[model samples]
Target chain A: MTRRKEKTELVPKEKQPISSQAGEPTRPGVFYSPAVDIFQTEEDLVIVADMPGVAPGDLNVDLEDSVLTVTGKVDEPDSDWKLRYREYGIGGYTRRFTLSDKIDQSGIEAKLVNGVLTVRLPKADALKPRKVLVKAA
Target chain B: MTVLRTHRFNDIWQEMNRWQQHMGDLFGERDYSKNACGVFPPINTYDNGESYIVLAEIPGISLDDLDITATATQLTLKGERSPNNDIADRSYHRAERDHGSFNRTIDLGQPIDPDKIDARFENGVLEIVLPRAAHALPRQITVKN
Candidate 1:
């Protein structure tokens, strides 16, 4: 009698968002959409976004109804030759964030230097870190 | 007098663009592309009772070409970058400078205290200070046990 091999089982995966021009879902690396890093501290949260090739004049940062949105565009640099290697290309970037009540929405701030966008969100008065004293019996 | 110089520079840059088209194609490597990786200047944010101070690094940009404005909650910066003229015919094995118009907007969560905001440009860096409204500051509280 010959031994028989058993078939392996396959798992079903969830559907993902597909690109408008292609039938397949978009992968993470192929395009550019600015990368953001957020750091939370006791007093505030700081967000840093990488938006190279963009000048301070072309960026738009807006905060409405506790939602923060950043929009900007970078024009293509002037050149006329065959491109052999490229790591960065000019493109548009837009991102939004819904803030929490603990934040002092009115006190949030943003700044752009070089090509980095920084946003600082301070905590509400009631949410700030405070030292509690123990009563002696 | 300051405005005239910048306007003239802008006219010249516009002419350069008109002389050529799709100049980016001349470069073979993408790293030297328009948006290639480069060290972005640091942004410093500071807060005082009345205002928030912001400083941005924008080297190679002339002060005359920059513009800064503030609204109740947003600060906008607009300016054009001109390529160095001294390097006339120097061919680049690699080029990373970004040339053209650029703008950056910053939102100070609090309403703009226009009367209190101060802006200045020096050495290619833009510094803006946004004052907080009296009512926008956090209030202190007393607790009883």
Candidate 2:
């Protein structure tokens, strides 16, 4: 028997649920529709995005005034159809997040390898754990 | 000696060469809009005794748009995704999907039995299975005293 997942997780259709009531909705030029998994280690935050059909040049990553945004676009394939069984339409992807002062914006990095977009944001010096040496009294 | 420290540093440095390259590329530019030029996905290859499997994630694409071709040593996937040309004059509250034309090609490291390849597409994922040549299989041997 063939088994399939009922529904894949999709980005929330509402752009910003919190900000919607505050003012007119922000028209985010680049929408990050890609599925991203965010993780943090002792020193940095890592964001892994699953952008299967997207290419390196097609990716746009921006860190501006404490906000991080990632955008991508993927094209469809060409095939002759006997009948329509399934449809996953083509659309652009957009994601945005407010940056924290503890992050080192200068050291943040992004890469597109193997259809995966990995963004690493290092923690700033002040945010890092420090060990103070005690002097003999 | 300083030479020893330099050598060790060089090993670590080279090990991180890809990381540095990627990091440099990441922070160098900031673009906020769609990219006019198109790019393709990278391919991965894995082999076992019976077959080799290739997997690619192709979201927001219809199965009809894809064209898969296999040769003795290569497998090619080509397709185009046309943007929503239908929607007009409505300001989108949010847009987070990518649409465009892309082609991905993977070179099977070893020669494969072209006639035995199998392919399946479902849920925006494409999988290609390539069987191994008969000679590539391992054979049993007897130990000598």
Candidate 3:
């Protein structure tokens, strides 16, 4: 028997000013496009993104005019230490997606845990598939 | 004199490794020998005089899924990222995140105090601080006027 993991509780979405344009630069510093995974379940569309070094308070998610944007800010490194070697660049993370009407904007939820952000966009009730029963005459 | 020479050699070797790693990054995800499905988790390392700070971007991983170990001159990180199985019923619109086991070993030329190392994970990032061995720390001498 396979055990299924229980769904995490959803938090109320926060309201923020949405940028007028999608993919437009809004914050300073090097902005890296974080790796993201989007998957659809029976009732929700889940998006998981990797954003290391981003704190909960520094993260912002906004949706406006069918565009969904995620941005994360990272603290600058200490000035006293000089960089002798570098394999990866430190910067903020930004990514945007154009959402469809099938998504229930009011029911959308997001959570950040352990450097990963998971956004759950619940599907509209009207878009869900329904089983039709045949009537025998 | 021999000990000093060995330390210098290690420094040079580490510098070369850094150059190679940077070149690999510049060329994009072509170094499949190390990680076949692209760099599962990219990392950055810094030296802060007294300790070495390493930060790795590994989001979606929980504490139970991560393992870190350090020797006097090397650090190893191993972890597994399980794939999302909840999406079996729906088609994917976009899938860029890679899932599987990952092991990355980093070589720090200067010896470090393994017992004194500190590590913390927050907001999808893992930060590690490795203090240099007592003998490896820089000492300032008083100047006679």
Candidate 4:
């Protein structure tokens, strides 16, 4: 039987861990599948991901061969602190996204604020809706 | 390292849970909460000599919208995440980030000064520092001859 958890909470969603995907990771640390929201408009496709404890400098967004990967490296907590109560583990975040040819790769832009990363991928010229002059018959 | 002692019910429960987790790890059991969802903005607690720090990961939330309350033994965190554009306006390919509001009450296990509890949001994590209550702190009495 598939283990499916009932959705009850309105705001707090559980963190999702990612199993190894494709190539091996160069850095040794725990990885999580960050919660993301993807919205597509007529002009652009926006991808927003939640990655807490990741500074702007620590975030990486790379797109190669139509495969876009987002990785956020988090700083490790001080080891001197003793763990008394535990709910989640300390680690980095990584998720892979496959983009289509319709997206303009050069137009991609992303920014991180308050632990949220938003990536804007503009639609290619061919994909954008063009208004053609209608010759009246 | 000296471990703080508290008689709260949550402390015992957490102790037992840690023990179970330790045993589970020994048996190579898969970690729970991995790929499984839990409460919003999962929290982890840590302790130093002077204070206990509670860290909660909250992404995309403004400090103005968040609320935090603390007592001698418990903490309450409340916040709301604003929704994006109207659902009808944009086509969402994937919507995994849950939104709305969340109120999480945490048991600190030890008595806190409450007045000294300091909380700040940085890099999307809500960090709450709960100092040990004065009465709970240990003091060495000098013996006069």
Which candidate leads the pack in DockQ? 4
lDDT string for model 3 (A26-134, tens) is: 5656777777778778889888887778898999999999899899888877776655454456778888889999999999899888778899999998989988899
lDDT of 4 by residue, B1-145 (tens): 9999664676887888878888988996646555325576678888887889988888888888788988799999887777654434677778887777778888777798999988888899888889999888778999999
TM-score of each: 0.37, 0.41, 0.73, 0.80
| Tens-place lDDT digits, model 1, residues B29-135 | 22232332232332445565556776654545666877888888887777665544442333332223344565666667777587888887643445677877777
**Residue B121 Cα positional deviation in candidate 2, in Å, after optimal superposition:** 12
Q: Tens digits of per-residue lDDT for model 3 on B36-125?
A: 224445666788889998877777777897899999999998887776674567667676665677777888989999999999887777
- Predicted model with the maximum lDDT: 4
**Model 1 over residues A56-108: C-alpha lDDT tens digits?**
88788888988887865555432332222232333555667788888998888
Off by over 4 Å in 3: A1-24, A130-137, B1-40, B86-88, B142-145
TM-score of chain A of each: 0.66, 0.67, 0.76, 0.83
- The CAPRI quality class of candidate 1 comes to incorrect
Give a tens-digit lDDT track for model 4, residues A20-85: 664676778788889888888878899999999999999999999999999999997789888766
Deviation in angstroms for B11 in model 1? 58
Q: What is the lDDT for B145 in model 2?
A: 100
Ranking of all candidate structures by their TM-score, best first: 4, 3, 2, 1
Measured with C-alpha atoms, the lDDT of residue A93 in candidate 4 is 94
Native contacts recovered by candidate 3, as a share? 0.58
